[model samples]
Structure formats: structure tokens, C-alpha cells
Target: MLSRDRKWFLVIGIICAMIMTSISAWQPQTANAASPSASKVDAVLVVDVSNSMNTSDPGKIGNEAMKMFIDMLSTQNDKVGIVAYTDVVQREKALLNITSEADKQELKAFIDGLNRGAYTDTSVGVKEAIRILQDGKTAGHAPMIVMLADGNNDFNKTTGRTESQSEQDMAKAVAEAKNSGVPIYTIGLNADGKLNKNKLADIAQQTSGKSFITSSADDLPNILSEIFASNLKLKVVPLQSITANGNYQDVTVTVPNDSVLEANISIMSSKPVDARLIDPSGNTKPIPSSDVLLSKSKSYSLIKLLKPVAGDWKLQVKGVRQDQIDINLVFNYDLELKLDAPPAQSYKKGDSVQIRSYLTSNNQQFQDQELYANMNAVLKVKDLDSGTTNEVSLTNAGDAFTGSYTIPDEHDYELSVRAEEKSFYRETQPITISAKAGAGSGTNTGTTQTAAPAEKSNLLPLILAGLGLLVLLIAAFFIWKAVKKANRGFVGQIVLEIRDENTGEKTYPQYKKLNTFRGKFNLHQLLQLAPEFSGTDKVVFTPANQDRIMVRSTPEITIEKSGRAVDTGSGLELKNGDRLTIPLASVDKTILLEFISVNS
Candidate 1:
């Protein structure tokens, strides 16, 4: 039996443990904490396929723009879907996770095969796109919907859907998208001078997206480029216009920094032009090679270079003699903005706090002065009690953006930072601060004094409840420890082989020894050894019993065994000598894992 002192000490220890556990459980997971290199996006393209589009867009430039958008996406694990709608949904393609060149080709083929239909319902297209995102979007991915329309609602009475009904539906869908934090970008073609610009602008504004109006379908590609850049927080830089003389013309494009994941060089011309790239090392890189991908349409040529070296690279373009060619480069950087903590730990009404924000990429500060020249930063503050938000501009002060915000009222407030340019925007996660009542607010000393006795009386029940929870936690800890020990003998190594589904080529078998790891073993830890498997960081394995291991994976990873799809949601079990094939839906590769047991 323990003495009174020891009993009190044990009780204090349990209480501290309970408090720590509760704090851990209550803290929210934030996207800002993640490395910018792991950025992933899920997008849906909603196209208007009404027959009227044929008159507004005689050259089918909208289709070409859609294809260009697809080519612009260079990151792995980015998923895209399509919805072509008129009076009803005429054609729909579910979100296809981009894994390889083959998947991109599949999407382009779908766009090329689009057929126009009679009647128009803008709401139908937006609604379908939102539904697809809601159903297929992955966690931690930025979601967006791009709707290209040529006309407003012209509902057909035969379909029994009225114009008023369409408007109602559109409003409902827009509200749903805004609530879910999904932005809807709208592009209106005013070739006929009849495009409903007001409607498009309203939708974009309400959903925190941008609106574009083009008088000529020829401008579709550039507008789409802006939309893509803005949605992904990238910047578009234009190069000097060139007059191609039917020969290779030297044009210089400077990659700003190492943070750029992809540099998309878009050449806009009336006809297709040939392009060649010479990297900073003076090596002539092959077009459509492993590092370079080129997509050409009737009006534009787009070249995407993956992880281009940070320096001046020369691009040579050959076009028809005396033809005018416009060049633009969009840089997709893996970057995030970080807002510094307040100088003071606590605050009261009328207290002023200085705000400092900086940009980061790959967990390192980015202070490229040239890039900062074209950007603007702002501080966004929200009053938690009133649910109102205000933005204050932050001036560039050398390496960081600086501003100040004064506590206006006694309430909890959230502060964040945003950096933007004409073509792109990026924001940081918000930090909350509480401002309490101060001297001028009111008299509160007597109220606080009267509540002390009631607060003391409530302490006993809270302590008793904590003690009960501590007892249960102790029992659970011992049970978990016992189970962990019992499964310790099931040590094994996994034989892994990577296969490209498109090429039908298999890599040599590799071995990863799963030694003693507490709780669960993460397969992503082993996959991280290879740069190609960078996006799959959530797959985990746990020991189920002495002879079997439980497999837990993200939805993007499709598992199969014995020619049947394994229900990963219900918990997949892998026994000794079991062979499993896991196909990552985001990339064009499959992993083959064979568990081989070894004695401990």
C-alpha cells in the first residue's frame, strides 16, 4: 500500500497525462504544416456543349483550351474530370487520377470527341462538376471547377426544367461549393456580344474565384492559362514577342528558383510551330522526353519541363516566315506563405500587434527579389465572435511582408497572410488569438470574485471524472502492450517490384526489412526511398495477429489479390507468403509486395 504522499503524486501524474492526451486530441490538423513539395490538386472542367456554342466558337477554341489545361498539369497525383452539359448532362467523365502519359491522352481524347447538343443550362454543368468533386476529391487536395459558357440559361420546355428552376439550382450549387471551400472559375465568351457577363462574374465572386471575358475564341488559351495559374497559385511571366522567319529563333526564359516544380512555355500562334529546348547545361533536351512534354494544337504549342534548372534556358521556335508569335511562361512553384506568431503572448482590446509573413518552399525561406517585385501581400483578420473578416495590405520590407493589426474588440480573432500577383494567389493558415476585457470595458472584479466558490465546488466532479478516465487509460495501455508483444514474433521482409502499367516493364525485385516498429509500419517510408513514389505517403501496415498483417491505404491505392479487388475499407489482411498487387491510381505504376516471414 502506498503512503498519502505517493497517492497524491500518482493522482497528479495521471491528471497530467490526461490533460496531454486531451490536448493532442483537440488540436486540429492544418494543411500549412505540410511541406509545399507535397502539393496536390483535384480539378473538374465543366464545358458548355450547347449547339449555340458552335456559332459563338466557330473554331472550337474552347476544346483546344480544355486540352491545353490538361497539358499544363505537370504534377503527379493530380486528378481531373469532365462534364459536358446542355439541357442535361450530355457527357460525363469521372475524375481520372493522372499517373502517366497514357492517362492524359485518355482525357484529351474525351475532349476531342465532345459533341454539341441542343438547349443550354449553365446550372446543370456547374452542378455536375460539383458533384464529381464531392464524390471523388482526395483529402488535402485543392479543388476547383472551371466552367466555360457561351450563353445563359435557355431551358427547353420539353425537358420540363424551367429557366427559373435552373437559376434556383445554380444558386443552390454555388452555395454548396462555397460552403465546401471549392472555388468556381467562370469564363464567358462574348463573341456574339450576348454573353451574360453579370451572371458569370457573380458566380465567380461568390465562390472566391475569378471571371474572364473574351471577345475572340482565340483568347481562350491565354484565359485558361490564367485560370490554371490562379487556381494553383502559380505565376505567368511573358517573354518578348518574336517574328519567326521559318527558322529556329532563340528566346530566353529564366527559371526564377529551385522551387519551381514545372515551367510551362506556351507559344501562341495562328499555326503550329516547332520548338526545341537547350537547358542551362547547354545540352539539347529532346522534346517529349522523360523530363520534357510538348502538346500542340492548331493555335498554340505548350512545352512543360519538369524541375527545370534555375537559370536562363534558350527555346528555339520555328514558325511560318514573318508570322507573329507570342510567348508566355507559367511557373508552378511548390511554395507556401508563413505568418509569424505575435510578439505578445496575450492581448487586450486596443492592443496593436505587428504581423510579419514570408514565403517558403521545400521548408526553406524564399527571398527572390525579382519574383517579389511582381507580387503583393496582405494580412487577413477574422473576428471569431462576429464572423466578419477584413484584409490589410502588407508592404514588402526586404525579405518579409510587414503590417500591423489592432485588437478591435474582446473576442477571438484569426490572422493569416496572402500573397498575390495578377495571375496567381496564395494564402497561409490562420492563427487564432484571444483579446480579453481590459480596464475601460466594464467593472468585472466583483463578478469574478463571486464565481470562485462555484468554480471550487465543480473541481471535485472534474477530478473524479479524470481519475475514472485515467484508470481506463492504464488498462488500455497494458492490453496494447500485451498485444504488441504477442505479435513481435511475426517479423518479416517485403519483396517489392515496380511495374509500369503503360509499358508493361517490371523492375528488379527489391527487399525492405520490416524490423521492430511500434504500432504500425508505413509502406510509404520505404517508398520514399525512390523519388518516383513521392505522392504515396499515407499507406500503412499494422500487425493484425501473429500470422497476419492489416493493410491500410488511401483510396488512390487500389489493392488486388487472386484477380479480385480487395476491400481495403473493410481491412485487408496479409498472411505470411501472401502476394498482393497495389496499383496507385495517381501514377502509372503498380507495386507488387510479397510478404516473407522470418523468425525473430
Candidate 2:
């Protein structure tokens, strides 16, 4: 009915209208897809019930506080489990397996009925907690462990093992928790002089958890309330390297409004830098040296903020000394890649090295989604020296991605892990291997030549030489006696006999010179001078006087002076045969520092 040009125009108009309608219909679906659902939290409460707790927790205040904490877990989909530990660990409730509020009363009743035991083995409790969480972890739930301890670990007493052995066991367990991606929240109650706040804090920080120290038992309820009500969420930003240009390097993060944000800037270098936080309002707050909490091994530093102002927050780092310093900026989020290699990084030729990689996101094991047919999820290892690459296929091994490779030759290799459809990439430091020692060649047996006959009798010369040797010995003895007396007059040196806790094998004795006995010296600083002391923090040595030393420790640590536990605030006077036993958290054996008189 219309002309040719009008007909064409009408058809084009209809097509345009249809296209607009289609887009309008897709807009809401797109937005809904982008919105994230609320995440559920699964928590485990590890309570200490050692004999000391009976007195420290008078009137069962701890029990009451825990009951109150359980009551506060009435959120929509919160799940919790209870674990009690003394000489052994026991799971009081398995409610963490499901998201339910029906068992809340039962969990509370169990806490109220907990009794004290003979000794405290914190490691066992933590391990049990990890096992439960790992077995029951689901997609939408985040796993966490909350440990409450009132005294030091006394598991060694029950097992008849050395304190160092117990500490090593505990350290291993904590490492396991870290690898499993479980955040550990440690609470030191009535710890004023009893609990080791530093150790507890270290455990928490390593797993992106928090440490709380409260002198009053009554405050536990309030603290627990705040921890739950805040609903902490983490957002991580990976920064591989930051060069020291003597200028302020800025890292910006957009934080949600009215949220508590703690920024942990881990600088993996020996050089220390000046760090500060800049708010969107342009207000700068410098992180002071005193405020920076150094890890036991001095490997990392953490700075916490209670309630951070919302908006763009910038972390400025200045005065970096290294050329290319490795830095990691962890925001509300915590993510870590646990790489396991042989204890000895260097391996012999023809040896196979098993490399394991575990990736944890927000304290939950991350599994790659099958979004594509060809996932390309592989852990790639390359021989840097030989320029050969090996792509090892990684299967989801429950908590980690694992693969193994045999070294083709003696060369250095680097590792890079790719997973989650290549969305995650982690490049690790290089590892080197050396050629194995070959068999020794047959020993040569050269012809033995007869010695020439001794010159005819030199009796007169021999007699004269003997007289000179006697005179020298007489003079040397007198000089040594005088030197010994001088050394005894002042504490010339202290001998530390380092031993392996696991094997009970003693290494060479380490010596430290005390130029003056009156001056104050930190035992921690002195121990750092020894290579064996590397990666060991929480070494407490307080010298009360020239003759006496005070060994003070927090929960899970014991310093034996002359085979006896040193009382807090008391000093052990150095007697002629006295020895100080220091338990290290990093190794298996206790360090016995014997006061050896130079004269003796």
C-alpha cells in the first residue's frame, strides 16, 4: 500500500524497537548476577582446661564468658564447634558440620560442664579443630579457630618430653593450620604476667587472624560481641615488588564505609621502611616504630586499625633501602600460597622433587570452577639455567594442588602456579640443585721411601733444647694462671650449649663475651647473633644481676633454670654448677646456657 522508500523505512523502525526491548529485558538480570551473596562463617572454640586455669579463672568466669559468646552466634547461618584440651584434646560438639541454631544450647551446656585437667596441650586442640573444619567445609562457609589459653603449654610434663620438644610440636601444628587456610583467633585471658601474648599474636597474624589480650575475664563477652558484630571481610591486593627510589610510593584501596580495616604491609627484606596511612580526607597517620608489632622471626610487621574511615585509603612507603623489595599489601582479605619443597632446597642429580601448592581464599580452600573445557590449570616449573619448561598437571587434592617432577639435570629452577582458569598466578623464588658427588677414584699407593739415617749422636744439643722447653712451659703456666684469675674476677663469657630437641643431640657450645657485667643486655639480641637462632622469636632472657638471671615466659613456653622452672618475677642466681635451659619455639631442643668460669 506504500511507496518503495516508505516500506523500507517502516521495516528498519520495527527492527530498532525490537533491539531496544531485548536490552531492557537483560539489564536487571545482569545486575543481579553481579551482586554477591552474604558469606557464612564457621567457627571453632578451643578452650584450655589445664589445672592452672582453675585458679586463674576463679568462679568459672571463663565458662560463663564462653556461654555468653555462644549465645551471640545467633546469626542467620552461623555454625560453631567446641573443643576442650588439657593433656589431650576432645571434641565436645560437632555442630560445625551444619548451619543450625538448634544445638546452640547444647554447646553452651557442654562448655559449662568442662573440668580442669592436669596439663595443657594447645597443639592437640588446634589440630583437632583443623581436622573438624577441613572435613566439614562447604562452599559458602568460612572456617576459623578461636583459642583461649590462660597459662603456658604444659604438654611436655604429661608426655615426659622436654619443653623444646613440645614447642616444636606446637609450631608444626600451627604451620598446619596456616597451610589449611584456617584463621586462628587467640585470646590471652588473665595473661598479665602469665600468658605469652607475643606467641599468641604471632599465630594469629600468620593466618590473617587477630589476637586479643584481656586482663579481666568480664571483658571477654564484650570483645566476643564486637568480633561477631563487625562481620570482618577481607580484600587482598597483590604487590610483588617495590623499588626503593627514595620517594613515596602510594598504594590505594577503596574501602567500604564504616568498616574496620586492618592493613598488613609485609616487607620481605632486611631493610626497614617508614610507612603511613593516608585517608581520603588527606589526613596522614604515620605508623610509629613502637606501634609496629614485629613477628617472632622479624620477618613481618602488622598494623591494625579498629574502625577505618570509608573511602580511598593510601598506604605510603618511603625510605626503602633494597633495589627491588618484595612487598605484600593485605587488606581486609587474607590469601596465601603455601609452597612445600624438600627441607634441603638443593637436591642431587636424578632426584625427583615433589612440589606442593596450596591456595586458600578467605580461610577457605579455593577450588577452580569448571567454566571452560580446556582449563589450563597447571603448575609450571622451568629450569632457569637450562631454559627448559615442565608443565605438571595439578589435580584438586582437597586442600591443595599437588604435582611432582624429576630433575633432569643439575640446574636452577623457578616455579609458577596457574589455576582458577588462569585467573591466579603465583611465581615463587628459584630453587637450585647440585650434581651428586661421584665415586672416589682408587687410592694411589706410591712407593714408600726409607728415611735417611738420623745424624750421629747430638746429645749435647738435645740436652740444651730440653732445658729451653722446660723454661718456656714454666713461664706459660704462670701467665695462664694470671689470665684465669682475671677472667674469674668478671663474668668473661657465657656458654650456650645448643641441642636438638627431637634427637637430643648437642651441637657446639656458643660463647658470648660479657665485656661488662653491670651493663644491661637483651638475651634475644644476643641469641640473634647465632645462625641457629634464625626465625626464632619469643626468647625471654632477663638478667636481674651479675650472678642472677630471670627467665620469664608466656603461655606454652617454659624456661628451666638448673632443671627447675623459673618463677615469674624471680631471678635464678648463678651458682658454680648452675645451668639455664631455654626452650626455643623454632627448634626441637632446649638451649642450655651454662655459666663456665674461664679459670675452670
Candidate 3:
């Protein structure tokens, strides 16, 4: 019973709301977004599974150390892939994006399943690792390869490969890795005194990586820790060493600032140790709770705490009497170093370009004055043509560190800024800036430069943006309808396994056939198959195009596939053979699903 004008107004309001929603969807997320993404790491663990390792690592301690390395990865986006090789590639696992505890467990399981081959050829391992990184590397993630071998090359005479030929192949592979900016950290085990130390050192030096030779297999965890920290621009801080008297001993660890995103406290001991952690608030926190993970091996225990409070925390540990316990702390910070681009794209010789570097946390300016009190910053300039490098010191300038570099010559140069403190450091991505011949003396060095005034705003762009937003809204509506129509047909059955984490009880495998169901299949319907999944009735699965199923889950529920977290907010598609692990946090239960054969 509304009037015509009132109805028109209502229509206009609806249109405005749709346009606003479209604009919001397209806008970039701000600093307040949940858990801002950290700089990612893509690493390939290349271990030699040669028979010689049997004599060198009889305890198979290397596998345990590698597992610790996998557990030390603290971020959701960090990826790890495993490569085992001898004379040939014995096994290879693709880069697995670490998103949940399941992914870490999967990686550790792969390491455990490694079997030794009869011969050793380090080249095959290195090359296979490089290939995996080159193929599966995520853009913007720092790529690295850690190779562990006894530094021997033994090919069967019947295979028709010689040591000289193998050396040539290794040289080529190293060059390819170096050109691709992948550093190869080499670990040479010399337990048998036959390790070719020079060979490993040469490969490391050529790729700007580090080389370590350990006489004892037990020293692996520390070496791996060092390499991990060094690659991530972090430092390993050794805490106090203590002797266990069969009673609980207290150790204090200091987290310097709030910028630290993760702090992994590694306790090394020969004997098993039990640890209890006390937060700054004097509350005893659970060791294996969400946001805190404790990984224990035969030789060491790693407690990884996400977003640790910035204060003194205490760790109480009980170990065997007279056992020496060594503790180390590695911090992964969200802090980033930003180098502002120069005023001009190209400059002439003798013209000084001002370098401005600042630190950011969670994608905003980090205004912690105390953190910058003793921090030192430097500008690194590398000559692209001549291959020479030089560093220039920068002085603190309130919010940013400022320095000036006069274009010394007419060659193109790559520049990066590095800021460091006692605890951690950050370096900016290198940028190339060019300078042309002919200029005056470098008199503008260390001088202030004024910024140009902003121009007047225009209305045309705003009007076009509004029209674009409307078009986007209309297109999105149609796309939604299309997707809904595509997900209508019956798919197949899903074999389900439900586990109650609270009681550590699991239900037997159950099957839910989907041939009778049409339209979207939701968890409410799925619950009939498993009475134990009491509270997961909100998750929905729609049959997507091409025999796939699209998933939509409540925000509180976490969904992981093969080791990667599925962004259920945007929707995720699953095909046949896909396995999904859904953790119903509200009910303290988990559901595992396997997409089996499709119905005809």
C-alpha cells in the first residue's frame, strides 16, 4: 500500500546499498585485518638418503632434527617440501603450504618414511630440490634449499656416469640456483672422516649460503636453527645454561618488543625433559594448546608460542640429574623495513638521491621510539655492471632513517636498506636506480627536498567510479546466480570419520550417499550420517561445476585440505580424492571427510 514515489525511493536505497557493498568488496584490506600476512618462506629440505648415512647417523637423529625444523616454521604461509635422493631421486614431495598442525604432521611423517638407497650422488638431490622450488614456489616467498650430505659422489659403474661428469652437472645446477636467487645451505656430516668439506663449502659460497660441518649427528638441530634464523633475518639468542639436579629449574626469557609475531624456545638436552611455562601474568598456560605448540624429539624440545607477550616469561623444566640443558630463542617478527623510492626515476652523476628508510609492523609505521634508540641502519649499493658493492651509514631522523648517496658513476645500481638492532633485523627488497653521465658536484648530499603540492581533485573519475561500481554489482548478482545453478545436481557419497577431541574417542567410519539429494548439501543433512558431529550443522557443500563440491563453513570452524587452510569465506572447491579435515572448535570435535567415486 505504498505510493509510487515512496516505492521509487526504496528502489534507489537498495541500489545505493548494493553499490556500497561492491565498493567495499573491491577495496584493499586495511591494517585492522585479522592476522596480517607475514613475509612467506618457501624451503626445500634436500636430504641425502644414501647408505653411508647408516654408518654416520645410526640413531637416525638427522630425521628427528629435520622434523624439528619443520615444526619451527611458525607462520601459516610458510611452505616446506621434502626431497630424498641418492644416485637418483628416491622420493619427492611437493611444496606443502603450512596452514595447520596437520600439515606439519604430514611433513614430519614424510621425513620419517625416508629410506636409504645404496649409492650417493649429492647432485641429484640438489637438482631435484631446485626443480621443485622453481616449479612450485609461491610468488614473493623467499626460496631456499637445505642440503644434507656426507659430500660424496658414488655412481655405479654400470650406470655410465663418471665423477667428472657429475661435478660438471653439479656446477651447472649451482649456477642455476644462484641465478634464481635460491641459496643452498650445505651440511657436511664428517662422522666417518670422509666428508668432502671443500666440495660442500664451495657450493655454499657460490650461492651466498652458509656451510656447516658437524662431527656429531646430535649437533644438527642447532645448525638447522642457525640456518633458519639467518635466512629469516633473525638471530639465535642463547639463554642461560643450567645443570638439572632432578628437580624443576627456572629459566627466564625476555621478549624484547610487541612486534615479535612468534617466539620458538628450543631446549636441548640428551635426556627427556618436562617443561611448564608461566606467562607474564603468572598464569600457567597449556603447552599444546591452540596458539602454543610443543614438539618433542629424542634430543630436544621446541615450544612455539604465537604472539608471545612482550615481557619476561619463565620456563620451569625438570630433567635427569647432572644433565646439561641448553636453551635458545628464535623470534620471528612482523616488522618490515621500507625504503621510500627516490624522487626521480633516473638521476645524473654527482646528484645525490636521498634515502629514506623506516620500519613497519602490521603494514603501518612502527613508532616505537625505544626500539630505534640503539638501532643502526645502512644503505647497500651494488654496481650492476661492475659487480662492486658498498655500504653507506644512515642516521636517525625522527620517524625514518635518512642518508644520501651521490651517484658515483653512470652505471645502473641496485640499492637496499638494512636496519638492525641487538635482537632482530629487517632488510628492504632491492630496487634498481639508474644514473646518467654528466652532472655537477655532489652538493645536494644530505639536503632536504620539498615535495610538490597536490593537484586539485576531479569529479569525472569519481563519477566513473560510481558507474563502475554499479556495473560490478549487476555482474556479481548474475555470477552468484550462475554459481548457484551450477551447484544443483547430485554428486556422490562422502565417507566420514568423526573424533571427539575432548575424550580422545573416535567413531567408526561412516558413509553418506548423496545420490538422492538435490540442490545444496549442507552439514545439517550430513549430520544424519554421524550422530557424533553434534554441532557442525552449519557447514554447507554445494555441487560445483565439473563434478566438484564447493564448501562454505562457519567462520569459527577451520577447514584444511592436505595441509593448506581453505579460505571458506570465499568458498573452496573439492574434487574426487580430496580429503578435508574440519575442526569444530565450538564442540571440541573434528570431522574427516573423503570424497569418493561420483554417482553415474
RMSD of candidate 1 to the truth, in angstroms, is 13.3
The candidate 1 region of ten consecutive residues with least summed lDDT is 28-37
Candidate 1 residue-wise lDDT, 1-600, digit = tens: 346787678667878877665555444333234423334678888888888887766777677777878887864888888888988777666677887767788789879867887889998899988987886778777899988887487778777888788889999999999999998888776667788889999999999998988755357656876676656666567786888898899999888677778888888888768888999989999998998988887778889999988999999999989988989888777777888776443578888888888877767788887777778998989988999999999998867799898888888888888887654567877787778655232233465457667765666666566777887876775577677666553356677878999999877556566775656767777675566776555567877766467887777667788667777766788765567887875688899887644421
Per-residue accuracy of model 2 over 226-263 as CA lDDT, tens digit each: 45433323223345467778777886755443422244
Evaluated against the true structure, the overall lDDT of model 2 is 0.55
TM for every model, in the order presented, reads 0.66, 0.34, 0.69
**CA error at residue 216 for candidate 2, angstroms:** 2.5
Give the Cα lDDT of each candidate: 0.77, 0.55, 0.77
Provide C-alpha RMSD values for all models, in order.
13.3, 33.4, 10.8
Better of 1 and 2 by lDDT: 1
Q: Which portions of model 3 miss their true places by more than 4 Å?
A: 1-39, 438-600
lDDT of 3: 0.77
**TM-score head-to-head 1 vs 3, winner:** 3
Name the 10 consecutive residues with the lowest summed lDDT in model 2: 28-37
Model 1, which residues run further than 4 Å from truth? 1-23, 26-39, 154-156, 215-217, 343-345, 366-376, 383-398, 402-404, 408-411, 420-425, 438-600
